[model samples]
Target: MMREILSFCALTALLLTGCTMAPPYSRPEAPIPQDWPSGPAYKDAFSKPDAALAVEVQWRKFFNDHRLQTVIAMALKNNRDLRVAALNVEKARALYRVQRAELFPTLETGISAKKERVKISGTQGMVNLEEYSINLGISSWEIDFFGRIRSLKKRALEEYLASEQGRRSAEILLISEVANAYLTLAADRENLKLARSTLETQQAAYNLIRRRFEVGFAPELDLRQVQTRVDTARVDVARYTELTAQDENALHLLAGSPIPADLLPRELSLVKPLPDVSPGTSSEVLLRRPDILQAEHVLKAANANIGAARAAFFPRISLTSAIGTASGDLSGLFETGSFVWSYAPRIVLPIFDARTRPALEATQVARKIALAQYERSIQIAFRETADALASRGTLGDRMAAQQSLVDATARTYQLSNARYEKGIDIYLNVLDAQRSLYAAQQGLIAIRLAKLVNQVRLYEVLGGGGDASTSPEGL
Candidate 1:
């Protein structure tokens, strides 16, 4: 009879699993475009199926600066924010392990020994007895045929992958920041050099005027004007020197070490040009960017949760069974005659749920929200890619023009100094030319750094987070 009852209960659990609304999850269909939106043609010739798409490029390698690479390496190793991101990957992995463990049965074992002395009422005498028992149990949660637990485990794994991708994204950003900061410091050093050189040149002219005044070939007014030019140049040089120091300090912080100036890059010389972004192929960033990968995992988790929510509407099945012996005397425990066993299957059906419908609605809405976030993430990636590509084109043109201006200003400054020395122009004219040259020089430095920074931004915008195969630290 007991066997028949247990068999019927198993059959009943299977029928309940079938009756529940456990829908199979599917990704919504999206319109896959054949080409990029802008005028980016693929190679202008037959290409071997996106040879560049084979692997995500290492941004550090692209910079090709050993100093920059070292700084980024240190930052990746020791930066606090990046460490926090790495820790999150471990948390996600633990969550995944917990979910995975749910797919298997659980076992519990128990043992107890007690001693009691009591007075017997109504029949007259005091009695003392010792009792002992031991139990072993094996139980399981019914997955039935609904695959609810399976979906949950799948969601957890996706989330774990997502966390790992997030860590990669952090790494990319940290490396980019270190490279950019190093570049910026190098530019500042150049500006300082230019300022000092200009100051010394003006001082030489001032000395020439002072000598002429002492020999009566120049007036006191001429000497004063030349002295003013020299003093002003010295002031500007000092200002830039201070700024250069600040930039160096910032570079040190970014690199996670205080590198000596001699050890650091001190002049802008490398030709790491900004990337020529093409925005190549629609939604490619979605597959490439790490943050996007993480977002999609979140969406997958939400979808899996929908099945989990729907499963709540049906009966829940859990089994518990035990084999044990109980005896009035401690010596009788586990004896030949002491044997007992019990098994139970629990089924809880929601017969009159007062608030369950709303709960299901909430999960449904949550799924929609996750889907919306995922879609929005894709749209944002596209927009960022477009913006980076457009800026790359625009900045390239602007920097070319700015470079010309820098060259022109230097030529003008040189001519103005020569004319002043030959008495064809005033000292004020030479000073004004120097100022123009300085401004143009600084502006060019800014633009150059912008171009370099944008190259890194383009890579980040492309969503190139690595896959699950990349191991998380302390995992």
Candidate 2:
């Protein structure tokens, strides 16, 4: 009988293994257009057929600078937030394994001894009784005829995938953040250097005017005007110095370790430019972004949950069985002809459960919510990529125009100072020219920094990172 029961259970499980009560799942249509938006903002955008996809480009190749690559590596290894994300992925994986294991019966083995007192029916006296047995069998294992357990397993698998994608997103964001902080520090340092240089020039002019006043060749007013320029430059130098220090602190936090002095950026001009990336002609690239993929996985998990909820309305079948050897004496427990077995199959059909309908409705609503969230993620990615492309369109022109202004102002300053020496103009003219040149130089530095930071933003939004191979689903 025990052998027959085991054969029946195996056959039943095999027959129901492929059955599922859940609705068929299909990916919803993307709510956005196939091609990227085009307007004045995206005028300069272009794509190359031979260029690698933004998602496939390695961070090391994109960054170019050896020092920055080193810092990013450090952050990936030690950043606390990223570490927590990785841990979460592991936790989700374990949970999925636990759920999947439910599809199979758990086999258990044990030895037992029993002692009890039983009252005699006729003698009105109590007698001791003892028995021993050894058993190996399954207990209360659900038979998934309705696919309820399988649906729950599927949901767990999708959730695990979603968690993995989330970890990748966190890693990409951290890399971009580190690069931005490093660039900021370099820009501030350059600004500080420019201010100090301007202050020295103004101080020298002030000294010259003071000497002329003492000799009765220049007035006190001319000396005071040059002194004002010196003081203004002094103020800027102090401000930029403070900013550079703060930038370093921010970089340190991202790196999660002290940066080597030699590895730190000294000036924006010295930092190498990031490699160019194509947005491709299609906006579908956004689907490959880690965050978007994570959202889609969440949607899949929700869909699977709906199937589990549907399965709940059907009959639930469970099997409990044991086969072993038993005897009144412990020494004879495993002897031949002492074999014993039991099989108890149970079924639970929901007759009047008030929560079943509401539970199914809740799962359907949850799936709709996940669908909306997935579409929203795609929209947000499109906007971010569009904004970055827009900045790219005009930054080159801005840089060129800024450089021209700096050159023009420098010429004006030199000419004004020469005219004042020859008594062709008032000393006030030279003071004004000096101020214009200093301001123009500052503007050029700012434009350069913007151009570089924009490149980083574009790469980040396009999901540029080198860690994982592209998913076969193309997301």
Candidate 3:
């Protein structure tokens, strides 16, 4: 009979698993254009659309710099923010396990002993009594007939998935930040070198002018003019030196440790540009981005919560059962005649509750909010990718133009110096030409850095070359 009772309970539980109050879930339509933007700005950028997913590209393959690869690898292992994100995933997994366990009964076993003394008012004596029992039982375990427990479990599972995606988002952001910081450091180093070289050349010119003035051959105005140029170059050298130091500090912070000197880029020329990537034709690709995936998982969790809230309005059933032995004496506790058992079933019907209706309404509203958030994530991703593509298209042309300007200015500065020495032009002409050459050279460096940084931004906004199924370790 006990075996039959257990089998019946198992069957009932199995049937209950099929009954869920949660509404069916369907992904909302993406609120962006079906195709990527096309115009003069995107003409060159959209030339090639690859079918390959971005997330599959390894960081090592994306960044050719060996030192940069080493820094990113170290950051992945030691960065505190990434570590916290990974821990959150583990925590969410544990919470989901706790919720999932509620679907099944929890069995407990124990032994108990008791002693009591009783006295009768009329009687001259008191009596002592003792009782003992042993039993195995399930406490008030909810039967989940309305799927409340199941819905809660579903919510927990979605939260866990969301946390996993959150971790991936952190990793992608970290990768981009590290790459940008490294590039900035390299650019600053190059600028400092240029500034120091310019200062040395200007100082040489200033020294010659001062000697010519002292010997009464050059005017005082020419001496002062050359001196001013030297001072300006010196200021630039100092400013760039400070910028390079700060860039190193920023890179170390992102790396989560002090960076080795050898790992730092020696000059801008040595830091290779990342290879070009094809941003796919459709904005649907943004749906696979980690942040977007995280938002969708959160929305699903909210949807599951609505099911749990709705289930609260229905009747709840719980069961408690025990099988044990009892007797007046401890020795007879397990005797055949001492065998005992019990079953208690409870039903909680909510005929009226001020909180239940409000709670359900709140969950519905929350689901709506989550849906908005999911859509917003999609919109933001679209804008970012579009902006990156636009910048990428124009940056190449701009860099090329700046390079040509540098070449023209350098030639002008050379001719002006020769003309001034031959007395064909005044000192002011040499000064103006030198200034233009310096400005043009600096502008070229700035444009080169922008072109490199834009590539990193494009890769980041396109979702870092991998999908949700890819492991975080792959970053």
lDDT of each: 0.71, 0.87, 0.87
Q: How many residue pairs clash in each candidate?
A: 5, 0, 6
Among residues 3 or more apart in sequence or in different chains, the pairs in candidate 2 whose N, CA or C atoms overlap within 3 Å are none
Task: Report the Cα lDDT for residue 420, model 3.
Answer: 90
Lowest lDDT block of 10, candidate 1: 40-49
lDDT of 3 by residue, 39-138 (tens): 9998777755553446556677888899999999888888999999999999988898899889888999878887788996887788877777898998
Off by over 4 Å in 1: 1-23, 28-55, 118-123, 139-148, 213-232, 260-263, 270-279, 464-475
RMSD of each: 4.6, 2.4, 2.6
For candidate 1, the per-residue lDDT at 121 reads 79
Q: After aligning candidate 3 to the native by TM-score, how far in Å is the CA of 217 from where it should be? A: 2.3
Estimate the overall C-alpha local distance difference test score of candidate 2. Answer: 0.87
Q: Against the true structure, what is each candidate's TM-score?
A: 0.83, 0.95, 0.95
Q: After superposition, how far is residue 35 of candidate 1 from its true place, in Å?
A: 4.6
Error of 1 at 106 (Å): 2.6
For model 2, the stretches where C-alpha displacement exceeds 4 angstroms are 1-16, 47-50, 469-475
Per-residue lDDT tens digits for candidate 1, residues 214-300, read 999877887887777778778878887887788878777766667755557777755444323334444554555777667777877
Root mean square deviation (Cα) for candidate 3: 2.6
